[model samples]
Target: MKIKNQIKLSILTMPENVPLARVTVAAFASQLEFNLDELEDIKVAVSEAVTNCLVHGYSNDRNRTVNIVCSIYDNTLEIIVEDEGVGITDVSKALQPAFSTDPERMGLGFTFMQSFMDNLEVRSEISKGTRVTMTKRPQQDLAAAASEEN
Candidate 1:
């Protein structure tokens, strides 16, 4: 896919910064022709990813950092959230619905990310940190879909 536009941001691993990352990515995704509901889904997915980084990845350590990259392609938006703090030891188990390491939380971060985005990929290692890549395409116009060569 040809790149249309992109934005990269690094934010502190603070709970307050979750909204900052969420709104920023949604604004960038707004460049595409996403509907209001689609935009909201994107925002929610972003919030989940960033929240995971802060709460699970960094364990609420304010000194850590989280990185976000939002890229626009011809018909899709790609968002990547990364952290350098402690990483997941079992990515498959972590991806399962309601499987949070924390007993107090609902453990639906990955679930929300998977549902809202068209594609979701997670990479992590015990001490190497985790990276989440999510992509979503705008609802296709009937004519446009018909015209595209498969």
Candidate 2:
């Protein structure tokens, strides 16, 4: 979506990419004084989304590239990870919590992302690859919000 505030990191779609993404997210989100939980959430969410690319997205091959962009706006942090691999066939199933194409995965990737962040979105095409946008909105708790409203 013509994203501006973002960073693209290209690497082999391997397990190591997870940590790499976590580190990158930490480095960037740290500037915002993100709490420990926030940092962990961002790292884990990014890793899961990217891992999906290496695994399901490139089930047949790993020749393509995975692009992940991180953005911050509206008091929210957004991460967009895109891969040019075999797209998801069933969007509903893939998004369902605890749904994984691979047996090893807990399918908690999306769940964790959704749990840690305020919003999550997934877009995929048959052969156009998948794009996952995870967003975390940092705001006061419901009680605080209610007080402010009053």
Candidate 3:
């Protein structure tokens, strides 16, 4: 589908930026007329994706950068989060529900992203970086809205 609009952002890989990343994406996604619960789900999914970049990719390094790109289509919202830090050695292992390289993490970031969005894709190369792309389709009254628009 053709994109209606897009937003790109680059922020430091600081712990504090996680919320900012998610909130900004959610705000952009609000144009789709999502209800509160749907908006919260998008926010949570974005938070998890950004937190993974901060905690695992950058390893909490404040100097590194996390890039976020949000796009809006007629019926979908697409979000991409990426970091140029240490990449995952095994993408499949990382996607496991309870597998984590760090002892403190629960390793459910991918799970949450997959559950919340209609599509989730992760690409990583060791020593290069990781990129997460997710897509969500809104569930508003599109039939009525389309008729009204016509």
Which candidate should be chosen as best, given lDDT against the real structure?
A: 1
Error of 3 at 46 (Å): 0.9
TM-score of each: 0.93, 0.84, 0.91
In order, the Cα lDDT scores of the candidates are 0.91, 0.78, 0.88
Clashes by residue pair, model 1: none
Question: Model 3, residue 145: what's the lDDT?
Answer: 71
Ranking by TM-score: 1, 3, 2
lDDT score for residue 112 of model 3: 90
Tens-digit per-residue lDDT, 10-71, candidate 1 = 99888888888989999999898888898999999999999998888888999898999999
Off by more than 4 A, model 1? 141-143, 146-150
- Counting clashing residue pairs in each candidate, in order, gives 0, 0, 0
Clashes of 2: 0
Give candidate 3's TM-score. 0.91
Worst 10 residues of 2 by lDDT: 136-145
